[model samples]
Each structure stands twice: as C-alpha cells, then as structure tokens.
Target: MGEHSKALEYYEKSIKIKEISLPLAHPDLATFCSCIGGVYSKMGEYSKALEYYEKSLKIREKSRPSTPPDLATLYNNVGQLYGKMEEYSKALPFLEEALGIFGKSLPSTHINIKIVMNAIDRVKEKL
Candidate 1:
C-alpha cells in the first residue's frame, strides 16, 4: 500500500504476461485491462482509464452476458470514473446499467442496489 507505484508496476507486468499467454479476447485479460483502467482512474488519468474500461467492457460483452456482477462492477466503476471526470452524461448510462443489474440480481433493498441508486441520482443532478 505504501508503494503504490511498485504495486502498479507489477500489475502491469502481470497484465502483459496474461495478454501474451491468453487468447486476445479472453475475459481474464479483459479483467486485467479493467484493473489497469481503475488504477489509472484513481491516479486521475481520465483518458487512459476510459480507454481501458471501454476495452474491458467490450471484451466482457462479447464473451459473456451483461448480467454478471463482473459486468455490473465494471459499469459502476467506469460510471464513477466518468462522474469524477465531470462527464455526467456519459456516466448515466453506465450507472443505469449497474443499477439494473443489481436490481435484477440482488434483493430490492440490498446495499449494492442502494449504492447504485445513489450514484445514479448524483449523476442525474449533475446532468
């Protein structure tokens, strides 16, 4: 935790290794791409984050259905990143998707559903 840079460096290396060893369209590789995007987003690198997040989403969509928590998590993550970037318009769709997934998969009163609902509301206010 204290050495975030070092941690990210290792993650990047591992991601590259996965890319070389796995199929180009592998979901695991997509997950790694999403992790990279999240790291970049946390570092306040919006463009890089958006690029990788989109790549992850595309790969996941192609390989699996969109209802998995993995897909919802990515949607929420990218939406939150967009929210942080003040791109509220773009954030809504992702947040909405996350909300839908949780609503369908989890109980109505689940914490995750509430969290996504709040996120959607926040984005709506901004837009």
Candidate 2:
C-alpha cells in the first residue's frame, strides 16, 4: 500500500508535467495513465483505476497498431480489474478480447496465453 501511494504520487506528478508538453492524445500520456491505473488498482481503487485505464486504452488504440502487446496488456488489465470488482459478466468480454489479441500476437507457447486463459476460466466460474 505504501509503495502504491508513493508510485501513484510520482506518476501523477510526471503525468501533469507531460500533459503540458505532450499532445492530449500522445502515446506516452497513455503509458503514464496506465501506470497510474495500475497503482490505483493495487490500492483497491477499482473505479479510479478503470477511468485511467480507459483513458490509456483510448489513446493506445488510436495511436498504436492493434496487434501490439501493450494493447493486449491494457485489455488484460481492464479485464482483471473488472474481475476484481466482481463484474464477471463485464469481465468476460475484456478477458476474451485480451486472449484473442494475445493469441494473435504472442507465440503459441508463450506463458501469457496460459495466464489469460486461466483468468477467463476464473471469470467464467464466477458467472
């Protein structure tokens, strides 16, 4: 918790500085937003985390190629957050989207596929 708060404070400060110099839709801003979202998620602030995650996702989708790992990672993060919030119905779609992207982007034997598969399964069980 202590580490998350510290990280959150730093990320917020850096993001503020970045916002002035960078365009509103810059990919770097997305990265910082995602980082802040991770910190919030760690601190159990799910809604706040989702807000940042969605912000990051919007920018990333617009700026980057759709097949990249980071986009898939963002999907996974949102999915996991939904799962944590016990929104299993909402969680399934995001997790499945992550799994699809991971499948297309990562090697067949990659560990990420297995991890996401397990997350999807867990969400399904809860549903």
Candidate 3:
C-alpha cells in the first residue's frame, strides 16, 4: 500500500537530513540506508534494495561496527536478499562471511549460528 511508500519517503528524508548534519562517514547514515534497503526489500524492489544495502555495507566497512556480529548481520541481510532474488551464487560469500563471523563471535549453540547455517544450507540447495 501507500503506507510502505510513505515510510520509504520518510526514511529517504531522514537520510538526507542525517547526511547534511553528520559527517559523511557517519554510521547513522549506514543505519538509514539499511532501513531504506529493508523497506525496499519488503516492497519487492530487489535492485533498489541491493543498492541501499551495498551503500550500508560500504559505510559499515569504513566505520567497523562495535561488534563483528554487526557486520555479519549486514552481510546476512545482503546474502538473504540475494537468495530471495534467486542469485544463489552471490548469496554464498556474504552468507559465509556472516557464518564465519558468527562462528567466531557466538557460542556454537547460539540461534544466530543456526540461522545463518540454515540460510547457507538453503542457498546451497538452490545452487
């Protein structure tokens, strides 16, 4: 519905404001990009979603999040989006990065570990 479009517009506005107010490399810009990406993903705009997600990743790489898992989560988001778009090959590395990070950062039995594992498995199945 229009609600999602409206939300996307609002997020875009917020991103513009943040860009003007914060440093060019600010992590909050990445957050806004991720939010917009998620909204685009939900709206089935895969290309636009990937665009914003990549922007977020670029910013995150520059900033280096407080936790490794934070970067992993972004990887996982991009990976999952690629998977959703049926680009299994593209999904593999990001999912692997996410898995590797989660493997190092969390306990073996952590749910995130399981989630990424399952996602990897699913992507592999598609491949």
Candidate 4:
C-alpha cells in the first residue's frame, strides 16, 4: 500500500508536468493517464481509475484518425474496472468494443485479442 501510494504520488506529479508542457490531446499524455489509471485500479480506487481511463480515451479519440490500439486498451481497462465494480451490464459493451477492435487490428493469435475475448466471456457469465 505504501509503495502504491508513492507511485501514485509520482504519477500525479508527472501527469501535471506533462499537462503543462504537452498538448491536450498528446499521445504521451494519454499514456500517462492510462498509467495512472492502472495504478488507481491496483489501489482499489475504481472511480479514480475510470476517470483517468476516460480522460485517456477522450484524448485518443480526439487526436487519432482511427481507433488505435491504445484506445482498445483503454476500453479494456474501463471494462475490467466495471467488472471489478460488479457492474456487469456496464462492462459488456466496453469489453465487446475492445474485443472487436483487437480482432480487427491484431493478429488472430495475438494475446491481447485473446485477453479481451476471455474478459468478454467472463462478463457474459456474470451477466
């Protein structure tokens, strides 16, 4: 818990600095947000995790021409977070979207696509 708090503190500082120096929709900013979101998720702060993940997704959606792999990752993260929150209905669409994007952008045998597939299956079982 102490280690996670320390990491979160550093991540927040880094995000603040990047926000000042980088464009609003910068890919690096999105990545930083996602990293912070992951930390929050590990710390069991699901709302904070979802907030940062949504911020990351907003940036990616505005800056990228098409659905990038990172956007897919954000979807997967948000979906999993909702699952952790036991919001199975909320989790389904995001997981399905992530699975669809991963299917199109990644190779058939890629681990990411498989992971999304497994998540979708798990969510379905919960539903």
Model 1, residue 53: C-alpha shift (Å): 1.0
Q: Which candidate achieves the best TM-score against the true structure?
A: 4
> All candidates' lDDT scores?
0.87, 0.92, 0.92, 0.92
- Per-model tally of clashing residue pairs: 0, 0, 0, 0
Error of 2 at 20 (Å): 1.1
Query: Residue by residue across 74-108, what tens digits does model 2's lDDT show?
Result: 99999999999999999999889988999998997
Cα RMSD of all models vs. native, in order, equals 1.7, 1.0, 1.4, 0.9
Per-residue lDDT for 1 in model 4? Answer: 95
lDDT (tens digit, per residue) of candidate 3 on 1-127: 5988999989989999999999877889998999899999999999999999999999998887555887788899999999999999999999999999998999999998899999999999989
Regions of model 3 farther than 4 Å from truth: 65-67
Worst 10 residues of 4 by lDDT: 61-70
Worst 10 residues of 1 by lDDT: 1-10
TM-score per candidate, chains pooled: 0.91, 0.95, 0.94, 0.96
Tell me the TM-score of model 4. Answer: 0.96
**Model 3 lDDT at residue 32:** 90
lDDT of 4 by residue, 14-54 (tens): 98999899999999999989998999999999999999999
Supply the TM-score for candidate 2.
0.95
Stretches of candidate 4 above 4 Å error?
A: none
